[model samples]
Target: MKKYPKYKSSGISWLGDIPEHWEVRRNKYIFQERNEKSVKGTEELLTVSQYTGITKRKDKVLGENKLLTNASSLEGYKTVHKNDLVINIMLAWNGSLGISPYHGITSPAYSVFSIRNKNENFSNFFHYTFRTKIYHSIFKTVSTGVIDSRLRLYPDDFFKLTTLLPPLQEQIQIARFLDWKVGQINKFIKTKKHILELLKEQKQVIINDVVTGKIDVRTGKPYPKYKASAVEWLGDIPEEWEVLPIKRLSKAVKTGSTPPGADDKYYSSEGINWFTPGDFSDETELRNSKRQLSALGVSAVNIFPPKTVYMNGIGSIGKVGICLDSASCNQQINAIITNEKISPYYLLYCIKSAKQFIISFGKFTTLPIINQEETKSLIFPVPSKDGQKVIVSYIQEKTEATDRAISRIEREIELIKEYKERLIADVVTGILAIRGVEVPEVIEDIEEELPEDEPEEIENKEGVE
Candidate 1:
């Protein structure tokens, strides 16, 4: 049984100050990250293995659409030999860092490091050390904002963090043992992720069956029908339904533009919503956002009263939602005014359904943006005013139920992951000390080389070496 310190931080606290001889340091200073690199784009390019450290980029490609490839032909791209560490600066926040154990070239997104020293105890020891949850938690907590996600730790910061270094012999044993253990955990996590994907497909199947009048098949057949008119997205509709451009159906299509200059104070976190493409999450009510901008501050910008359906026209464009209350949008989003002809709720649902396809049509360099005309062109099956209400209410109830169920499952998975991290920390650190393990040393300096293994006398200690 593993023994933990008696001073108790509850179930497990794997960490404590190391021996006086050891030290905590940032990783960047101990090893220099290579730059001025380009992908040769050829000769067995390497890519991050979603499950492990390194794999042939093409080997992992599966299924119908292989949109992303790690193919390389250019020779200039840097090569990473076995035992090198690589971390994607952008995706690092998402736990994208891994040790490379195969011959491969990483994308420029990764900061490749060559281990300078070869202390057997600390070489791969540091690599596994970084995988500890406590270490990465420290890395992620400091990062925030758009660029915060891209925070890259240089060697200085990296080497500064303290390490609880085990003795040389134990280091090798622990590294090899935990390496296998981590691989198993990773496989388990991947299985959970795959199961989640299947659940989503199953849920979509449920939606298709019920929403398209497939479920309750016999009685749902003769539900209702409307005639074909010039519907926005769907050309023909029920005979009794009205087909009209959104322009005719609502107040003018008003696009919000930002005022020329404003201080950050104008965008207060506590005021009315100052929405942008990023602020929108739900496709339902555009309601006030978690983020707000002061009315006086946004006065120079295009502000729209709430209760209007909002569509993002900028990057991540075409997400449609209804505003919960009075709010203003930046130029990239359009605050739409709808008239009595179409129920706002119904229109929001139609837009929400079409948004994915509409967003696919967005065209722009950096920011994929959609024009008002394209948005208005989205077509849908129109029911009579009364039918519109029925369909809207029905779809809302169903979709929200699906969203809640999915969210609950996602939360449970997150908690499982947290528990898993705690387990790893307890094992890796001394808190849940494995039997026969000695107290750890906090590494202070990167060492240069490992001592040679001593020769042993002949003995039948084991059947295998």
Candidate 2:
């Protein structure tokens, strides 16, 4: 990382100074808002992300969550061409804007703009610049909304912002240098993520074996007498254990709902803990939520008691957690308030072990879903209350070391991502010059490569809408 030979004031306070030869121009001079509507709803659908830039909507890995459809959605979608800048207007302040490398139709809600004077400017260079933290802050200042999530970056405001222009060759060189470096960094991230997956699998195996009686947690020895659990997935359990449907072990089994309407008054900064599938992770206990509901909102949804076992019933079906406190959830989750017959921790472990079985019920659906009836009917091997406690404690003690290791690895991945963001901002803003950097030839994964055909012709005739 090296600095430019000379620098000058950018006139833009946030930008401070830039390379002497670079030009500062209003975005109106650099980009024109694209208003082309898809004549036929046959183009590939695209989505913008803060993390990965522009990507095919279908290619996004949203766990088992598939995009739910609406009637004739792509019919009036905005058409985007290769290199056009696409912004998720509502999320522009969060860096949800990027240069599209594919020709596709995006949501009518998004704003699409084409680069002006393409021969003199490079889209990739500005793509890097616009997505930087500095620009995100700038977007926040100009965006119009009462709250952060609702902030919108309309076309007029975007056109008024000043942008930097580097020499065309230098822009190309910087973009190439970043492409190579980012590819290398991504490969490292992929490896780290794979390790995380393996660690999770290892923890799952331990839970699966202990909860299913494959491993005797009590005496660390084989059970003296074993009996067939009758349930196909349960296999066998200790002779004293009973295989019971969740409905029999819980006093109540029901679902929660979102409050009607999108009004801000329905939500509050200090409202009820409202859990959603998005709040879940690789943790047994569910606590904090990203959004909270007001007292009025609480009246619209069911409030389950503390220690209730909540299992995701739609999209990412089968993911389970026990509420650490009284909480409310959306309709996509089934709340099972257990009775004296079962230990909440043991129920959590059993449900975690049975995830694959629960998931199998929805494998053929467009979106994975297991309604309340289906969830209540699902069976689990249950032991005596005291026995369940012993097993839960044993499992927790055994998995403590593995959990610590997972946390450390997760932190490392977070730091690496932060570093990548900082590097992109520095290089794009001319703070760290890549003018003479010799970018190495990097071979990206086959999946990451763009199609060889003309982008506009790369169509998905049967669109999701």
Candidate 3:
């Protein structure tokens, strides 16, 4: 990357200086605010997102649904046209503004603007500019609200903000350069993400094989003999293994309850660990939680002893973790206190293997939930205490390498993403000169990394579960 031949300050402190040939103008001079509304309630509804630009509401693939009511009239809804910039007032600081590629209607709460400049290339240039970290900071300064999420960037305030504009021809070159460069970076990221997914899947397969006795860990070979378990999902297990209901193997199985709301006396920062499904992770043991309970809160709830296996019975069903210390949980979790017949670590693996089956028993409503009785009735394969210890040790040893590899790949992906963002910001803001620069040859040959000796014919199983 190279800098321009000469530079001059734009008089805006955040902008610093730009190429001498470029011009600075307020947004009002470059864009005309559009407030036209659709009379009919029907129009192709569109949504604005921070990840994706303006897209059909039905085409949104991420985030929760916020459109709760069906309005009888869309006369109050704003009409948006292709190439028009749409800003979600409340989320503009978070990069929820973008140039629309579709003609539609959006919530009246949003503001719409159309480029007034005739060059046509300015739209693409500004698209990248507005999404830069610099502009996001500027938006935060101008926005008004008590909290970040509630902040609004009104049309009046937006138009008053200063903008830097490159020459019409230079704007086109920069946009075209970025489109190619960013696309290559994104492809590299996608490849890394796929590799991370494969590592995780391999770990899961190893766990399943050891827990079900499909493979003997000590010998690293499949069992020669097997017997039908009669349970469909469990399929077949080693002849020596026995399947039993969870209730029979556990001394107690129960769910906790939340105390009354808004009671400060019952909540404290330095109390017993209060576990939630969100606190559960890939780790087998949980030593801490996002929120802790007060002594009063623990007294009002059941505090299970250390080593108790906890499974989410509601919402994120099947996530399991073992308490490293005495902990209390909300009503959404079911804790199992196993007897000497079962190893808590082994039970955790068994429940994890039967995740889909446990989820099937849940009642799907606004939130899915499995009652204590249903959880207790679920069947689990129990091996002798000695066998349980061996299986747990085998899984830990086999998965440690895979876990490290996955963590490394994940960290690499984050670094790559950060680089991509910085590159875009530098190029779009005129801090780096894209003109006359040749695209790197390495960008074209970036290949997806895969495990050694894996069959290319196998379908690429990508993404973490």
Candidate 4:
């Protein structure tokens, strides 16, 4: 083993400078692949996972391998030796790759390659590097033809990828450093995620208190004041407040059409956003659409101006967003065009908080529907316009502040999650090895899942480990 200096630079380029004694080589020059077929097998089966790496062979996870009755003579499945790297080349883009340190049997879908190199640097380094962003880029960038979503990487492309090498001693060292650094970043990210969860809980608490009248907006207090004169959803709203149906309140109920898509020239990357379910998923509200349409697209569909109250229906029923600018939604949405006594912000808060209620009365077996009449018949709590103004103003200031803080923390948490994923990827791949790392042993998931039936009868299964 040799002592290597800690050199700093951007990206993975600095990874190339290994200890002076190491041999460097492309993957193609070092290994030959044996493509195996599926026959009767008794190997504890394994399957490739994108979010998670390869997992232990269970009944259906290898899918339909149960028909074989042979005690131990299955020969079609290829054998993987401990510490040999195995990847599902098809799902590699999604990071469905892992190292099998315990020699095991896996599904024929996986292309199991054993590094034939007798050199010590090979095993110590190959597992880690294959999962790195640097190596993945090398493999993906040069592949010809449209890569099939389901097809595993061919031997040709798999063999041609660029590789970074280090002396046997440094391979171990780099892996160790990556392990330590990623663990630190992961801890920071976990802390931020916990804080975000706490903030969300606090936000929900405030919303429940105020909305449910547990906290009186009038007295600026809670739990003491009660009123007998109340409506169903608006039960016991402050006496001064008015309960009204949505039909009399709004100006018009309008829906949008799908934008024209035949003309590619009309739509460009620079056009204004076209709001869709993708835009509002997970409560994310910003101005970016997967597909942008032009003026024709806008005309073909009704274009909503900024500040429109957009609520989703069908597919993602009751999901709501206040459009920040002019945009159109598919026919699945109802954009209310109203201004009188309507605080878009207040309406937004009300609708978002009441989405479950909105969908509660909806009817359908395969698909649910919230009727326009039902939407118009929605009962709401209305304080004085002056009170509405005050509350809306208060909510704006408070929520904007909360949203900004939450956004910042959430972004940090995301970066941390990436770091954690990268850390795991690095460790499992052997690019950076962390010895004796603690895996949260008490995974509650396995115990909670109630499978519909015994899993022995299925073919091609996807599971979370």
Candidate 5:
């Protein structure tokens, strides 16, 4: 990275300093808010997202898009043209704003802006600059709101903010440099992400095999005597294994309740380990939650003892976690206190192995939910208590290395993303200059190398099934 020939103080605390040649201009002088609406509102719909920028609504396949059905006509929707910036005013503080590459209509609640000087190549420069955390922080400070999601970067206040305007040619060079550098970084990240996914899938297969008795973990061999599992998804199990419904194996299957939200006395910084599905990753133990419950809150809910397994019965269904200590969960979760016949760890693994089947019983309406009856009726393959212990221990030993590898790769991806963000901020702010720099030809057409499909059944070379 190289610096500019001269420097000057930006005066703005967020933007420390910039190249002396850069001009400090109010946004109003650089951009004009556009309010044009589609007469028919039939143009391709578009959306602004923190990750993807402005993309056609049809192209956003990862998440559900809420459509306005009550609108008698599309005439009220705002029109956005190419090169225009669309800001989801309420979500601007979260970086849900971007430059549009397609002509389309968006929700009327959004704010649209067009560069005032089209010849200046400022659109690309501003696109990167505005998305920086520094700019988002500024947006949050100026926006009128009590909380982040409610913050609104209105046209009046947005235009009042100052921006650093580098020379036209310099802005183009910086943008081009970033386009190449970020592409290279993203390629590396994609590769690591694919590896992480395969590792997780591999771990899931191991859990499925050991818990179902498909593999005898102690001897690293397939069970000699097997019988039909009766369930289609669960092919076969050891002849001695029993297939029983969850209701038969648990002393009690109960759901917890939330304390009254208006009562602040029920919440605390430290107390019982109150958990939600969001608090723990799948198959992990629940040690802590984002929100803890006071003694009163715990008393109001059903508090299960340690080693009890919690499964999310609604919303994100089938995510299983073991309670590390006595804990209470919200109504969305179902806690099972196992009987003497079943090991809690064994039951947890069985639930994880049959996750997809359990999830299939969920009724999808406004949200996905599995009623208590459905949860209790779900059957699983169960081995003897001693056998269950062996299986659980085997799974822990087998997947330890895979889990560590996944965590390391995930951390690497995070570092790469952080570096990408810093690189963009520094380049666009003129802290780093790309003057006469030669970008590699490989960067011009860099594409992510996708990981090969992982085998559904991973074979152990040492003869473990």
Candidate 6:
């Protein structure tokens, strides 16, 4: 990282100082808002995201949680062209804005703009600069809303903001330099992620083997006497183990419900912790949720006690977690109150080990779904209380080292991501100069480096904690 010989105050305070040769200009002078509205709206639909920037709607394979579909009629949608910058008015503060690589139609809720002087500037440079952490905070300050989620960055406010104006050639070079560096970083991350996935698969195998009685936890050897489990999934289990349907092992098997309407009053920041299928991940404990329900909302749903095991009944079928405290869940989840016959931890592992088998029970519709009756009918291999304890301990002891390795690699990925963000902030803001730095002739997708087609893919690739 190098700096120019001279520097000058930006006078904007938050902007601090910049290279003496650079100029600070209002966005209005640099960008002209495109107000063209489409009559037919037959062009490809476009979307902007904090992770992926601008993308064609069809490019993303969305999940049930955040499905994107076309409106009844595409009429009146805003028209976008290549090199145009699109901003989701309500989410601009969260970095949901980007320069489109394709000509398309976007939602009217977004504001579209194009650079006024293409020869003297580059949209890609601003795309990189604006997405930096500092700009996210700046957008938050300028956006107007009653709450954080509702904040909007309208054309007028966005145009009023000031930005650094690097020389045309410098802008291109800086963007090019960043593209090369980020690609190298992303490549390293991909490799680390592959290793992490293998570790997870290995752990899953261990859990599946012990919980299914495929392995004897007591002597670390095969069980002497194996019996036909009768259940096809549990072919041959220890003679002492029994195959029992979930309904037989639990006091109750209950499904959750959503409230009547979409009223915001039904939800609160300090409300009851409400779990959903999305809340269950690789972790065993279901501690918190993305959204909570107010008392009124809670009235419409059933709350299960702590230690209750939750299994996904829809969407991501078979994913499981246990509540660390009393919690209410949505319709997508099934809560099981295990009787003295089954330990919650053992039941949790049982559900996890039988994920693929449980998934098979789901009716393959537009999205896989399993109802309460089906969930209650799913069978598992059960052992006595003492046996269950031994299996649980065995799993903990066997997977502890693998879990630690996974955590270490995850933290390494997080640190690298943080470093990448900091590097972008410094370089784009002129804290580091790339004037004489040579950029490779060939660079990968510049703006397309971060965002992936699926949200889950992005989580596995760039997200780990």
Judging by TM-score against the true structure, name the best candidate. Answer: 2
lDDT of each: 0.55, 0.80, 0.78, 0.57, 0.78, 0.82
Residue 445 lDDT in candidate 4: 26
Per-residue C-alpha lDDT of model 3 across residues 1-465, encoded as one tens digit per residue: 788899999888999998888888899999999989988848887776665557676542212422312444566688998889998887788787788878989888888999997664468788778988889889989998765645789988999999888888888778667767777877888788778778867888888888888888768887778898888888898888899988888999989777666266777888898887668766788878987889888888899999999998865678899987998887878999998889999999998888878877777633456888998898887778898999999888888998788778878877987997899898877888987876554435332232221111011110000
Model 3: runs farther than 4 Å from truth? 36-45, 56-78, 216-232, 237-385, 438-465
Model 5: lDDT of residue 418: 92
Deviation (Å) of 354 in candidate 3:
4.2
Model 4 shows how many backbone clashes?
Answer: 8
Model 4 C-alpha lDDT per residue in residues 173-289, reported as the tens digit of each score:
555554455556656655676687787666655555565455665567864546643555546766556666677667766676664443565465777666655466334254677
TM-score of each: 0.63, 0.84, 0.70, 0.58, 0.80, 0.80
| Runs of candidate 4 exceeding 4 Å displacement | 1-24, 28-128, 143-155, 167-169, 222-269, 274-285, 288-304, 310-320, 328-342, 351-388, 411-465
Ranking by TM-score: 2, 5, 6, 3, 1, 4
33-91: candidate 6 lDDT, tens digit per residue: 99999999788878777877888766663444343342567788899999999988777
Model 4: how far is 345 from its true place, Å? 2.1
Tens-digit lDDT track for model 2 on 69-89?
343456878999999999988
Cα error, residue 332 of model 1, in Å, equals: 7.5
**Total backbone collisions, model 3:** 0
Candidate 3, residue 159: Cα displacement in angstroms equals: 2.8
TM-score: model 2 vs. ground truth: 0.84
Off by over 4 Å in 6: 36-42, 62-76, 219-281, 286-304, 310-319, 323-337, 356-379, 445-465
